[model samples]
Target: MELRQLAVFVAVAEELSFTRAAARLSVVQSAVSAAVRTLERELGAELLIRSTHHVALSDAGRVLLPEARATLAAAQEARHAVEQQRGGLRGTIHLGILQVLRDHPVSAARVIAALHARHPGIAVEPRQAGSAVMADDVRHGRLDAAYLALPSQQAGLTLHGLSEEPMVFVCPPDHPLAGRAALTLADVAGEPFVDTPEHWGTRIFSDLAYSAAGLAREIRYEIGDLGGVAAFVQSGLGVAILPPGMIDPVASVTTVPLTDAPLFRISLAVPAGRPTGAVTRRLVETALELRDRTPTPAG
Candidate 1:
């Protein structure tokens, strides 16, 4: 029932490995095991199913994981509140940033810079990953907040729209579709496309767009970053549909507007129904303020 025991159990439940959880908590493996055992003894039920090589959460663990996270979050919020009243906020915020947005105006760098200027005591730890991974990290309490490109509604998370731009088609200068003023999904249905992996935010958005139009395109090249996608297109490997500003002008590629393309949106995602600590709240506010001040990139 102790907060320390609950914290240890939650770490093990999330990592699903005693060694890894201990490493994350900066404690020894035996200490982590002892804490989990003490928590199970008090709760009267086994929380984790442990084996020599693997660890899995039992039904009881599954039921307690979310509650444990909420409890820990509440306790942290209480501490942050008292600290804020005393002088200023001081805590580390684990933040996730989408790789595609590394060059964008309202990127993690700008947001972190602004937040730091306001609160010198707060520290931000930025992790770069795809939007889907970032969203899952936020939902599972691995990250305090993340910049994500996702649909309007995601389970167990809240998304705040920051910027939106229409998706555009990019191809080699001599490609057939490059001469067109605009394109529809059907126009590119049979062509080979260069796209990110299926889990990436841009890929997910394009998939939904094609599905809505009852069309499917072949993904010929799978690149992890927008720059690489542009390179593949410039080399005549395949065409791509990406957000504005993603395909640099220096690349010998042509960008054509889509007639009814899906909007590529960037949003701020946080865990739903959880109390926001003072540090996290201030960071969110600063991000929103900066987003409003920055101009939207042209499509």
Candidate 2:
């Protein structure tokens, strides 16, 4: 009935002698006999034929040997898997994020690759959605956690600021302000502007920068995606203030820093009261490490 009993049974069944099985198991011959006898009684079958000169399997012994061996093997494998999970990590980590990271291209792949390297059994599943929706899902237990630009104040969410990336203004290289050492938000006041949708987290930095500079907002157009906003500016349609992740398509656009704005913030979001397990914490930490290691784009 017990795994130990089955283990002894398999050893005795294979060796066909309690004396040899005891040597293999590092137990006394009498103890081995007692263990095998206990197994026989629990199974309600006589498992061996033994006399003064020899030992052999009974019909019931032959029938149960293979099954007993199989059971012990399976139990050992299950124990190993459980131990691995307890000591290292093994399971799927459901990760959620917003458009900025979802479209970042290397972001998810990098984090997943790191998980694979460090713990092959830890599977990373990346999901993308709006920031508010990201929070809602984590709060409801739909997702384990997320890398999102945190809102100013949100109940039921714990935000950890991993790092901050300063926002920059993008314009055609030939634009008048592109040559400045550093520009203020007021300097771009009247320039036709293209930026992320006002609902986006980065928009808070943009709006706050404009308000502090006392510039009337004059946006030529609003785009939901930063890539699109970058492209629009490269084509000379307008200027845009964007985060670093949006700098990929800059054949013609010039990015200049806003010396007086709050840049942008990076934070991890998890349900305040939900328990964060080991795998969940690793995924979040991996995300933050990925951002910190991002390569500076070539000019």
Candidate 3:
């Protein structure tokens, strides 16, 4: 009636002895005997006749042996088919991303291109959102994976952090620090700053950078988009502390390091304990690889 029962029946039928069958099945002989007895009781018939000296199949046992073997084979096949996905050679996968990566641009497009090139049937589903919202998407089934600048460390969540692109100070090209060979946070500490919305991860990075320099950032404007903040700085409105990813090399704006800002890393957020498919795995790898093309710290 059950797969295990069928396996036991086949083993006992082949071995013609419960002891050999239990040893082959790695179970006690009494367990094998009890299983055979249960199988017979379920069928309302005895399938084997055993004595102190010999064991042989009864008429019912002979009738059921072939069917039991066939059933076990079918069960094995079904299990194998169900497990084929684990081999990690195919399948479509979903991916999510923050609306803006700290310093990476169109991060999904690069990952998608790489996944499609290697695996034919694979595709990427991208969701653009803030780090807070994206974190939830990865937790729920809505997203297969995501990129997070800063995310809450929750159970059932996994992270693969790729690189650290710390927040830096930016100003109009005509500003005093813009003409220097290198600049520091102290250079712009006295000026009004374009700051993150003072809510979460991005904000913490900017604040820490200035705090490390022994100065509180003079944030004059607080907005969500770093690119927009850069544009505001380019207008000579004020100098700002911005992440390396947020700047697109706008001609009028110049970016400089904040002396010793805490490294704001970019991490790939995935649901913990869920199996990763081939496409999803490659996409994360591609994102890590992209980091090489970005600026590296001064040696």
Candidate 4:
């Protein structure tokens, strides 16, 4: 019923622990519990199933979570609009960034710096995670927006294409496939490959590529960081398929063009069909501008 109550409920639903939610909101645990109880009484429905050790969203809670998020976003947008009219935007933008963008031209640091320079009153909180997890976070209202790689279309999120780079084949210099002028998925189908874990954007893209080509490849090494893939390949543990920017030139690995390479597409994802706050909009614009200024990586 009340905005404060809804805020408390959202925090508890997200953290799934009264103590953690109270800590996050900087409020006492009793206050958090009181707010949730008031909300439940007003709604005439149980929102969360609480136990001593765990809390899970009930069916009604799951149904109300997205609506609560939308309502909160709308309220924030209204406040931000009024704040902008008065002077400057003042709010926090929870941003999700990809782990593999450290070496890329559209660096997250650059984007954040630009946002800060433009809107000094706004605060940007950045969290690094794999693209899939970031996307999910954005959809669930945990993150205001995210810079991530999109392997495919995601529901409940709007993706603004930032950059697209073709994947390259990486292997040791002396490897058999290293001498090839170019390679295809079929060419590397039988070779041992090194890649990120299944949930990572790179792995999902690679898997989709192989699946589309009706091919299956063996993954001998699964590295978490894109930077580490080169090391695995340099040691002759296995080969890799990654965007050109991800391959370390200084490493002992060789990068060959992929004739049928899958494109690694980066995008800015935000929740679809909802109003975004001024801070979130400004951050999105900053990211897009930075992406435009940075030259695309050559295949």
Candidate 4 Cα deviation (angstroms), residue 127: 1.3
lDDT: worst 10-residue window of model 4: 99-108
Ranking according to lDDT, highest score first: 1, 4, 2, 3
**C-alpha TM-score for every candidate:** 0.89, 0.61, 0.58, 0.86
Error of 4 at 72 (Å): 2.0
Q: Tell me, what's the RMSD of every candidate?
A: 2.6, 19.5, 17.0, 3.0
Residue-wise C-alpha lDDT for candidate 2, range 219-269, written one tens digit per residue: 888887767877788889999877777465545688887787555665677
lDDT of 4 by residue, 1-299 (tens): 88999999998988788997898788999999999999999999999998889999999999998798788878988898898889888899888987753457777778888888878889889898888888878875678899888764789899988788999888899999778898888988899988998878888889999999999899988988877888888888899998876666678888888888999988889888667777888988988888888877743
User: Model 1 over residues 198-250: C-alpha lDDT tens digits?
Assistant: 87889989999999988888999999988889899999999999987466657
lDDT at 285 for candidate 2? 78
Best by TM-score: 1
Which runs of model 3 end up more than 4 angstroms from their true locations? 1-92, 99-106, 151-156, 180-187, 198-201, 208-215, 273-279, 285-299
Badly placed stretches (over 4 Å) of model 1 are 15-20, 23-29, 49-67, 101-103, 295-299
The residue-by-residue lDDT of candidate 3 on 28-125, one tens digit each, is 99989988999999999999899997889999999887677566546644554454556424454666665453435436666677667765556566
lDDT of candidates 1 onward, in order: 0.86, 0.72, 0.68, 0.85
lDDT of 4: 0.85
Tell me the RMSD of model 2 versus the true structure: 19.5
Looking at model 3, residue 243 earns an lDDT score of: 64
The regions of model 2 sitting more than 4 angstroms off are 1-88, 98-106, 151-153, 212-214, 288-299
